[model samples]
Target chain A: MSQPIDKQRRAFLATASGAAAATAVAPGVFLHAVAEAAPRDSAVSDSVRYGMLIDTSKCAEGCTDCVSACDRENGLDMLLKPEGASDQHWDMQRPRWIRQVKLKNNLTGRVTALPMMCQHCEHPPCVDVCPTGASFRRADGIVMVDRHTCIGCRYCMMACPYNARSFIHESVRLKPTATPRGKGCVESCNFCVHRLDNGGTTTACQDACQHGAIVFGDLRDPNSAVSKALAQYPSEQIRADLKLNTGVRYTDI
Target chain B: MSKIHYREWGIESPRYWGLLAVLAAIVALGGFATLYMEHEGHWVTGMTNQVVWGTPHVFAIFLIVAASGALNVASIGSVFGQKMYKPLARLSGLMAITLLVGGLIVLVLDLGQPARLIVAMTTYNFKSIFAWNIYLYVGFLAIVAVYLFTMMERKANRYSHGVGVLAFVWRLILTTGTGSIFGFIVARQGYDAAIMAPMFIIMSFAYGMALYLLVLMFTFNTDERPLGDMVVRRLKNLLGVFVAAIFYFTLVYHLTNLYGTENHAYEAFILRDGGVYTWVFWLGWVLLGMVVPMGILFHPALGAQRGAITIAALLVVLGGLSAIYVIVIGGQAFPMSMFPGYTVIESGYYDGVDGMARAYSPSLPEFLLGLGGIALALLATFVAVRLLQFLPTSLADEVVDPHLAK
Candidate 1:
């Protein structure tokens, strides 16, 4: 149950990076950029590396508590609904850090609710393509972007196959709330950094996921629901063939 | 034996001061707008989640493609046996370099973080086509600068002919790479078409000729140096061929998209049923950008009229720029969904994707940034010609010494 120190450090760096970078997400968080799950240090044993198992079938209808809580906790100043013309800044134009997607299968004629957030992919194209080394994914499988180092070229926007990154475009007249919005940078979903720091398992979507549709835990551990869900039920990843090795997975209704 | 005194090769009296003044005023205003955009966030442009990359990108790409095309005459005259094109050679070279620089400036200004543009280059994203494009474009611009510089060198011990030729060859590859950026994306409905890259190349040549013709007219008005009819005809023919090729590509691209089993949502909206963009693609692009211009130039009779030729060139340039605008802007204007049935907003009023999503309209600030790029281009052109002697000062040098090898 042990490994080399360097490997451990790398794991810590990866998750920390993912969390850090996710902290900078602009256009409401997207599920992307999380590397493999592994134990970083032994003292952190029984850490129960947490994640959410989102049952798309029964996510709450329109209560965006998860989304708003995430914004409030992260200090993202997101909007469920923008106030006026100038109030709409690129970072949180319509802050649904955790929002339910109403997916309708064209062929099957079946509809389902799927809560979308940062997938924290194992092979994140955003991280791979980040020119400034600004984008990073964690060992615990979380994705994040560092706003301080982010020069804002937005190549990441184009690189993302999932269409996640949003440019903090010139909102000159916009009087932003003292939250995290900044000009000349790219931002997107960071699975609630404050909640994570407080030893909370990604609170936004999970707590609001009233039907107990959301499961968060370490997939690497067999005891974890995420692992149990994968082991028991048929699951799917977004654009799976892309080989992004995404952390987020969905099960049937 | 004395050489044939064909014509002078420098920009003399040009009273286009009115145009310059107006543009200068606009450029200053644009600079102010740029400052504002930088100060705030991207609330200036109309781009939203639905319409991410907008008009500025289209214009940036168009200008770059046109800039690349402007190099062809140089290639033809140097690579082939077209002697008449020699007089305007330097002008075309100068314009190509200028326009390329101009395109890059606008592209950089449009970035959410302009300073971080270099980061993409330094960081390699093999999966992302855009990453490769940024690198290739920079490479293209570098080579072009060298090529233009080489051509500008004085005949005595000049060392840029080979350099210029090398740059010309690289330009083609660079443009092809640019095309692939869009062409290779199979997922995006309107973009999955592979012919997009070649179509871009052909379109560039059209823009190149259109721009060259426009430059010639400007010169004529100022009496800097009048171009011979033979040379102008070559320009016309070059444009005609390019227009025809682009038209061929466009027809095939759409027809294939429709003919195939793949249910394309984007192209279907644009080429077949979409409202405003359909007109843009069909008439503005197919009819105006391609067909009419092709008709005007392809006809032997119309080719004889310099005035008519000029008109054709004008249409070709207009249509080409518009085509890119329509493809980039209009492409996004349409809703995006791989599936159908659930009240799909099938392009009625660019009401944008998802009722919650917003539409893109280039704000005054956005427009200013775009103009600033153009101004930067003009300024670069003026400085290049002034200092490096990029313009042909003597027609004697045009034929006097082909090789600068002491």
Candidate 2:
């Protein structure tokens, strides 16, 4: 039987061996090369505007896989209640990055269930109202809080039209390396920027969804899946009346 | 004109120390509450993600705007060239600084990261109204300090008019900034109106004057200084005008909201359906804060009486708190409109359940914390008056009005 060699794995092995050899031969040069190679184009660029498209028509009612997955990914599940707080109270107090919302149309008598998170508006009110400049939008269109400077004033939470932001009311414990959160700062969904930095194309919610309801891609690229879907379908922003120009869009809402 | 003498409070009586000790105890209690809330996180307070700013903000903002208004008496003296008010100017400047410090302390202590206040002071987000307010607040402090100096020293008295004018204009801008904090919030339906700025300015006038009168009366009576009917009558009438102006602004604000079809829901919620908020609006803001005080101020039998004026002033202060509570807490209680026509039937988060308003009840710590701010302001005033020459020796009709002496 003829077997094909794993060429990419072989190349990786060769690179690893070469790096080890260089480290032994000249430690200083090896360190310099390693430092130069490690950055991996992490600088955010405006050329790619990351966004999401939710096909609410395909979204099933009472499906909370996306919410649970978001919790696991962001370490939101590890939030602890204060000593005497009831479980019900803690549920309301804990930070929720994403939630499955069920909306009923009064005129049409139609019901729909869709996942709601940060709309990541081009003109985010949260960013505009933040006194400390801690709530900011990346060049790539990801809105996030810089926890170090958040100051926990909760003004951003008031300014958010979608109620996307949550204040960390209690101390956090057992958080994942990818997500770092603490008490007193506002937090929201970041479109899984950690996964994107690691070269993963899909978010935890998108990956976990069984109904194929969520699509995540670069909106600036016409060839990207999100762009193509937006072009081919009629999509609606949650609060289009605000004219926030949200990066997140939904179809058949 | 007789040369007016300024004197330190100089009341070394046990009663004075006892009053100081009570105020100090209240301040200590507030400090303790702050530490407890900070250590336990915001979970201890009724403030949730929905109602981010709770009772503390109501008090902080009240004290802040009142600080600017407190300086108005001095402005009348120096800027408007009212000779009768000149003697009151020094005390006005002192109250402005002390009240501002007290208000700022409550605001800082309530922050999520109080330790990171240095970041707030240093960092600049020019687009934010809050950032502009930080500058406005600090600048007001500096201007008032200089304004105080100009009033105190004989050498600096020539520059008093210039400094007083600057401080007067600075406070108008300061109060405008305070109102704009609410006005610029485009997301909330209860706010985001152009009228908020002017309304706040008027409110500052009413609240500040009421507080100033109470302070003046308490201080003069305690020190046995000759406070006369002439000065008291002028202040009382001026306060009535301010209170009436506030009523006018509030009426116009609600009327403007009523005209807009989009604002009907908000108006209805605040005016009617909102349970505690409705009570606060009609009873606290309208009945007690406005109508009752207005009746007392304009009454044929009671308006001129000193005892009646004091009661009216106290009522106005209570009413001011009610108005602020209605604005701040009530505004947050109403849910944001995520979908205009659709109702949220189910949600993982508290999306107001069925388009209903969120519930909020002020805890003991929250009220204690708010009252602590007031105590702090009074304590500062008490100590400063005792240490420095802030109070005028006399405001007798014959002394204040030279014509009366003649």
| Highest TM-score against the true fold, candidate | 2
Residue B241 displacement in candidate 2 (angstroms):
1.0
Runs in model 2 lying further than 4 Å from the true structure: A1-35, A38-42
Q: Which ten residues in a row have the lowest lDDT in candidate 1 chain B?
A: B344-353
Prediction-by-prediction clash tally: 43, 0
TM-score of chain B of 2: 0.98
**Candidates in order, interface RMSD in Å:** 5.6, 1.0
**CAPRI category for model 1:** incorrect
Report lDDT (Cα) of residue B190, candidate 2: 94
Candidate 2 local accuracy as lDDT?
0.90
* lDDT tens readout by residue for model 2, B1-406: 4788999995657979999999999999998999898888888888887788999999999999999999999999999999999999999999999889888888988888899999999986788888999999999999999999988999999999999999999999999999988898888899889899999999999999999999999999888899999999899999989999999999999999999998898899989999999999999999999998899988877988989999999989999999999999999899887888898899888887687887777877777788899999999999989988898899999988999997
Best by DockQ: 2
